[model samples]
Target: MTLAVPSSAVAVPSLRVLPLRPGALLLELVGLEETLSLYDAFQQSPVAGVLEIVPAARTLMIAYDPLSLDQAELLQAVAARLGKKRSVGVTETVDIPVHYDGEDIADVAELLGCSTSEVVRRHTEAEYTVAFTGFAPGFAYLSAPGAELAVPRRKSPRTVVPAGSVGLAGEFSGVYPKASPGGWQLIGRTPLAMFDLARDPATLLRPGLRVRFHDIARSSMHAVEKTAVVAKPRAGVPSDIGNGIEILSSGLPVLMQDLGRAHMAAQGVSLSGALDHGNFKLANRIVGNRPGTPALEIAPAGFSFKAIGRGVVAFTGAPAATSVTSANGDVASVDFNTPIALDDGDVVALQSPLSGTRSYLAMRGGFVVEPVLGSVATDTLAQIGAVALGAGTQLAVNSENVKKPVLPGEQPAFAMPKADEIVTLDIYLGPRTDWFTNEAVESFLSQSWRVTPQSSRVGIRLSGEPLERLDRNELPSEATLRGALQVPASGQPVLFLSDHPLTGGYPVIANVAAHHLDLAGQIPVGAHIRFNALNAFTHIDFVASDPQ
Candidate 1:
């Protein structure tokens, strides 16, 4: 069926284009319908240099290669595609059997001024359209026209929302793909596995699809549970290991990371990779491994491993004390950013880094871990890709990517910031800078925000003077980038890292400069960060060209 432009929408809705970074732009539309229409148009006619397009509630984030396309040309290309009549392909209709027995059903009923049964009736009766997928893999936001079931989110979000949970927030309803932290008001649950890597499509729901909820008894829910398919583990290392590493101890689970799954934002997958990209690359280069070769991303807590056969290895990133012990009991200290030769039965151990949060260990041939969705990156937030490394995990090595000679005297791009130091990062104001008050914006740039212990690969949580905001309205979820300084209602800003959710609802006052993203990722907990704005906030105005 053709997706008709809503009667309320003008022929040419002005687009508010804002710079997200050096190579990305966020285009704000009037509403979801207009956003979807523009997305469809882009799909029909691809734009040059636009690597990926992540569509959200009312905006589209375009990530491009700056060398291939300039901002002005990209803006003109987007303007030319605007206001075009496009057809949406026919999508499948999926029926989910839901048991209307959530913990918040009664509270939702009271808020809507309706009985619990009425709440279930209205929800089951409405046919919803999947507007977009985000927050997590396979988690789709469903929208129904003229639906009066709108409700506000919970006052305080739950620490863990169970998988298969059906929830509603604002004007949309969705099912939780997996158990994770959430703030939505849940009304029910479904037995269907919303996301299963074993399945061909992986995700049960996607944008433009039709969804219907069927009320079912709790006992009958088991019948549909079989549809939930669990992913099988990849092929294990051969018993007769010729060359590999045996993890003797992993204090904090180590993750296999490469450059991450790119061009996958449309499916709600984050660009998760090594937090410190420069260090990750340096480690790989030192060991003579090809770029993007899978390597071990170690936390500051430290880990130890044993070599099964001869190979070359290198450690980079954090300034950690490392040493290798041979079977003869001879111990030799290792230096950061230097190649180390590993012999059979050699035990290598790394102590907690004196500075920074993560380190990288790269083997000459790269670890033989299987890739998920075309990458070996493990997204902690999305809970996908390679599994975390633990004690007793044996990783095989292959010489498929050993292309260059090991470089022994390589140096890191920058020094890791110590916990007591105050690191200054360059930022460009934008997409939602106006959401905060002038004082808040000024304070954000001038204040020294302390990085709290609540930091992770997902983001670096900062605590400082609460940034005052002028707009208290709930911002619809939009595409987020690494190093986005997102301010929530509490006035605290979270600097998103590699594993940040693809879409976020908080307002992003600024984004760290591209050159400084790796540095931002290495900031230690208890450290202080002072932001320096490269340019003041400015809006981009573009007039739509004739569709004809």
Candidate 2:
């Protein structure tokens, strides 16, 4: 069923509502002005059930708790705020010194039919406002009103764009925060750090701020050297100095994870926590640690650690071959999902998982690690929070987050799918489902997609029949969520995981149901998946009427 807007409310830049999921909705607007205006209104007076509002170039994604509000109520609340005056707040202007000696400077000038000096002049003269932050932490998309410095992205993106490189693409300009792959047209490089965790806010730019670029000489650039800053554990937390765990060998990088940072999507931060949320909580519960207590999220296989002092620990998630060695060199196999007492000289080792991909280890207290932005979860893409664990890494534990005593006996374990197994996951179609043809949607539900080995905490990249698109135009980047099946131009859909990016330009066909997300995360690489649609595709259209 489609929700239609009132005919009397038709006006310029009409509003349309699209169902993103059961708990989320995407509001389609005309441009940045309409998007930001509504964003400011929601910020000034927030709705009751609205958990987050992520603004983009032409859309606003709103996520809420289904228990607190329904879709019809949310639509009415949003309609009431339309055409409301935006309250202006004090805006800060940041000045960045740039060296205009980029490799693309000449190319950009030639494309604009102007001289290199004119290109530099045009960039430095116009004032740009921070439209939205995405792609990466501290990477803010800047918009310049009435400026003619627009350019297209390169045909092929560079594998490694230098950090702090100023670039322009389409109608926006931005800086690369930490040197990842990019396709923007580089015009210059900046000495100022775009993102620093040591700072109070971490990111240098935010929404509604003004930015100015100044041309600098080559000789002046030598004074400022780019350096990487690591986030340390917050001060004032009590620690057990002598009692700790020391890593002997880690086949893959083990990371500390909790519930993850919330309400930070406005800064391009994703909700990066343990991939298996159910097991993460169960591990902490068995170890008597409170919810949100930091724990070790180990990858499938070869991990060994030694106890510096007496403690209790529990292993959960994927089933693995685990054993413990005593000080006198006696070794004994151990069972999982149960608490094990450890001595000072005891060494515990884990082999490759028999089924799943990730395992969780929880201590009686919790891992003593410094958190970045109130979360211990490491965001691999954004490079935020705790550092990855490797050989020789030592972690302290304390009772600060303990709530109860350790539980006795073993917890029943569920069967995890093996590599050759085929699992079925439920999905809800929407938001961008109309972009695909009916045949494509049917094929998506019928065909079996293999979980490629290229998958990671960021997303589960699938290999299957390419789902053809009905509309192949470039989609403006909009907010994304965990479990979203984002279909790129390659026709393959990437199921976003816990560490997925906040926004993307690809169209999402469906979203995995929330109840089955934990199971989806545990599917081993090479396993096949069949999608079951819970409902048919429905388009929701909403136009604001006179509030009086």
Candidate 3:
């Protein structure tokens, strides 16, 4: 009934990997024989933007952020050094302790047709090396799930696999690093924290680092118990920074965000922030602030804030009805579009969105919160920023006696994108477009695609003709970027969003441009969409117009 295969036994086809764009994509030869060689290659002449060299069972996965360079350019640099020889660093390895007890542990034993102890023996037989860092922040897929023990992920996924879980799926064995929904066949758990926000390097270890996990007594689970504590460090930030905003009433899912953490992809940190960036910045502008300044990305049923004095504020993208009811119940419909003045005790709240799917509410003198790794972006998937702005969390208020901006700029007005009945998204043909049949690509380009209900900040699921893969490519998990078009085994093509994982095993067909982000953001569940392809010259021409 199951289609899992043993790693060692799987017939090899000589690793038929090909260069997609070679300019931005990187291919690393991993597996114990030569992967570790890249260590010296990196040390002798380190390449800029060469994020990290990960080592795993005879291979390595190289990771990078394409934002630093276009996909085509990044891959060329990698191909240029295809045959270079290097040495694995003779560095000391860290010993991590793990408890072998997971729901799927027994299932894995049966698949291997061996005793559970034998499974553990094979797993710990050799000192495993981290091939590359990916999946999520702090999640490292190590190379040691013994060929026999290697198995595919569960047919159905677990919604919340806890942090520290040790799992085996395919030839890969990894620790969850953080609590998340996963389908990896879990075999055990580790006490060692794979990802610690308070800890330096954020991700304790990276690719190529030699790691040997020791099995500890189950009783030690409590001895090495993990405690999650999020607190502001006692460092000297500006004394004027107040304890953030006081939430009178949150209209909907309102949370704080920032530009996000970059350069951590090799260590598995995802860029998590407001889903609709256009609206995010527009909200910042409404508050008399530069775009990209941290702002409250409010959704429909916008949140209400009562500031102590008049503060700069702005709103934009996904235009929604907004109102500020004074302490005396004087309602300001704000037809004039400026961030209405708010003195002490003034209360403001937004009505349900009239057109767009989301709204942004930004305040001038950006909310001063404890910056983590020089960023306030919350890795919602990793549970990393000031406790995800729960009901009672106070926003940090910058108290430098800020002077309010002169009469707010003429309220920049915009309407919601055209959706509901039919949606049109312009796209570039693709990175892995060749993996699919030409007919499938045609179907993707011309057919009507509907946004599925399972969409989230991570990715948008679509209901359409399954874009079938022409050939089964042994995809080496590579770094995935925002707007990546991925057609998984499920046949549906998913458009990854802001919170997507740093790398994935899927074949990304194409990437959505930044300018079209706002348009894609407003496509709600059940929305029907049509895809259109554009050239580089045409892309420039399309953005020539302000509206998408």
Candidate 4:
């Protein structure tokens, strides 16, 4: 539905507010410029519980803590903010050198019915503004008024597009920060690195930044490419003594993670952390470490670590068989939620979990690692943070500070599903439920869907009856979140996880409830999942989401 813009600066534009999740709201606005203007205003004076305010093509996503402020109060404040006009601040201009030798340059020229050189001329002459950042870290969508070089995305997305590859789709242009899957029409390539985690400000082109492309000779392109190097790990003063465990063998994509990078969705970063928060916190507390401490997120199993110095440690999430072998050859099995006293040269081994997909291991003082963007969490989708764990890795820990007494009765175990179990999750209908047919929505809730093996930290793909759409119009890319049930052209649904992309161009029928988000993350491959729709607010039978 379209709304008219206000004629007076003090008049508010008609806005449509939709519940994104329990504590988040998706505000559909007039357009990009208005979205950015409101985004700037909110940044200048943010609400108390507002954690992240993400601006998309035509919507603004506000994430908040429900405990700090109620949704009604927050919506009132937003309405008041929209009542007044806000100015977009002045932005910086960045001239980028481009090489007109992309694989699809000639194809794009033919599609536009122009010579390749003229296509290059049109691209170079236009000045583009960074409308928003999404898809991947450092990938900025460039937009300009009265754009003349618009093109559709490729029918088939390439499995991998090289870093610095410039592409265009619809009314926007972007350069891929790293090698990843994409559907944009490749027109040229740039040598400038778009994102560097080692850099103080990771993204070179931020939102509202003006950018212009200039063509360079193929010979000079080599020099420009040489300037783009991976950011080196920054050296830092050790905050703790270099005492910790040495990895004998890291089982199945182990990673060091804390509560991931939050409040940075505008920068194309996802809130990726531990899959199961309940288990992560329980493990930390068991070892006398504070919550948010760096811990080893162990994927289903075969991990081994040797203690360099004696320390107290505990494991949680996904019940698994753990064994501890002392330096004297005394081996004993350990249980979950129980702190294990490790002596020097003690080796700990973890087998595959009988249930669940991942586990958490925490030490008394927490693991010490170089943090990127104030987090040590590894976002597999964005490829941010420390590299995946492997053999021959040596990590340090902080000083064994205040050790809290653990009550015997306080040892709590997290629930995990048995092998090939069916998991039922509650969901709340959209932001975009109207996009799908009524039958499709019914199929989504009633049908039994199996988690495909293609699932990962990015999202869980489910194969079932195709969900037919009510409208065939293309959806503009918008901000996405964990548990978003996005359906693409294939009609299959993909439930997003912790490391989901910041934005997507698919229609989301429903979002898994906030309370069951962590449970959604634990679903293993081949597991059957049934969606039970619930009333959005009243927690009663879900007859209709919004009566109005």
- Candidate 3: tens digits of C-alpha lDDT, residues 255-288: 5676676666667777677777766765665556
> For each candidate, what TM-score against the reference?
0.93, 0.94, 0.81, 0.91
Best by lDDT: 1
Candidate 2 lDDT tens digits, 297-344: 998869999987888899988889999999999999988888999998
lDDT of each: 0.86, 0.85, 0.64, 0.80
Backbone Cα, N, C clashes tallied per candidate: 0, 1, 32, 0
lDDT of 2 at 121: 96
Give the alpha carbon lDDT tens digit for every residue of 253-322 in model 4.
Answer: 7888888888777678888988887778888888778889899899886899998777878888887899
Top TM-score model: 2
User: How close to the true structure is residue 462 of candidate 1, measured as C-alpha lDDT?
Assistant: 96
Worst 10 residues of 2 by lDDT: 1-10
Candidate 4 versus truth, CA RMSD in Å, comes to 4.4
Question: By lDDT, is 1 or 3 better?
Answer: 1
- Model 1: how far is 515 from its true place, Å? 0.7
In candidate 1, stretches whose alpha carbon ends up further than 4 angstroms from where it belongs are: 1-10, 86-88, 113-117, 223-241, 542-548
Backbone clash pairs in model 3 (N, Cα, C under 3 Å; residues 3+ apart or in different chains), count: 32
Q: After superposition, how far is residue 411 of candidate 2 from its true place, in Å?
A: 3.9
